[model samples]
Target: MPQGPLFLARAVYRRRRLRDAARLLPVFGLLLLLLPAFGEQSGNLAHTAIYLFAVWALLILAACLLAPALSRSEAEGDPETDQGPQDMGDS
Candidate 1:
């Protein structure tokens, strides 16, 4: 009984991820920022969040600029579908 619901939950989450990766980026970023700021003084987690947002922003911008080339290469070879670690970048 527990295994069945767990599998269903995982599958549902995976489906949502595939539908909207952008929606998740900010959420994970926020969790990364908020979760660690619980104890102590000064919030190092905020700084970490800023760094993450910066990296994510840069990657999205770069990906947009190279969309044509990326799509072409993907259509041609479908890297992740057929290749190794390099293909992880493909949409």
Candidate 2:
């Protein structure tokens, strides 16, 4: 019963915060795609496209920067059950 790297990855991804963040990524991408539609309403297609592209790029960069911090915080908050000080002399 040996688990592979994929199993380990899935386990880490199951963390609540990480899972929520993963779910939000697709929704964010969808919003980015839909942004052009809203810009069209403003009657300045080119400007709107440029603005949305910049916004989309910035958001992706932010997400990449924040993802590692999120994982580190989650790891820190979860206590390791296998390693801890044990009481002695009271068997």
Candidate 3:
């Protein structure tokens, strides 16, 4: 028996990881924002607010960055498949 390469194309692998990151970003942000609530200093509204805002900003930035990469990846993957609604030729 012979062994074969176990890795995907670099572009495909990166696209998949990026997509995973994009999907998990909200959950990550949620966990971070909730962390303050579980801490001993939960009464400090100012700190919590600042943490929430920072997380929000990071999430927004991540989304902005991922959007273009994802769109570009999809564009690179297949153009023919994404074109919507072929003609039925009823004419």
Ranked by lDDT, the better of candidates 2 and 3 is 3
Candidate 3 C-alpha lDDT tens digits along 1-91: 4453587667767878888998999899889888887898637788778878998898899899999998998878733335688676753
lDDT order of candidates, best first? 3, 2, 1
On TM-score, the stronger of 1 and 3 is 3
In candidate 2, where is summed lDDT lowest over 10 consecutive residues?
2-11
Using TM-score as the measure, the top candidate is 3
lDDT of each: 0.55, 0.67, 0.81
lDDT of 1: 0.55
- Candidates in order, TM-scores: namely 0.30, 0.47, 0.73
- Model 3 / residue 47 / CA error / Å: 1.5
lDDT of 1 by residue, 1-91 (tens): 1133334454345444443555565676566556545646575867767766886786577456555554555455532245455434655
Residue pairs clashing in model 3 are none
- Tens-digit lDDT string for candidate 2 (31-84): 877777765475776787687788788778868966886777667653333357
> Which residue runs does candidate 2 get wrong by more than 4 Å?
1-15, 38-42, 70-91
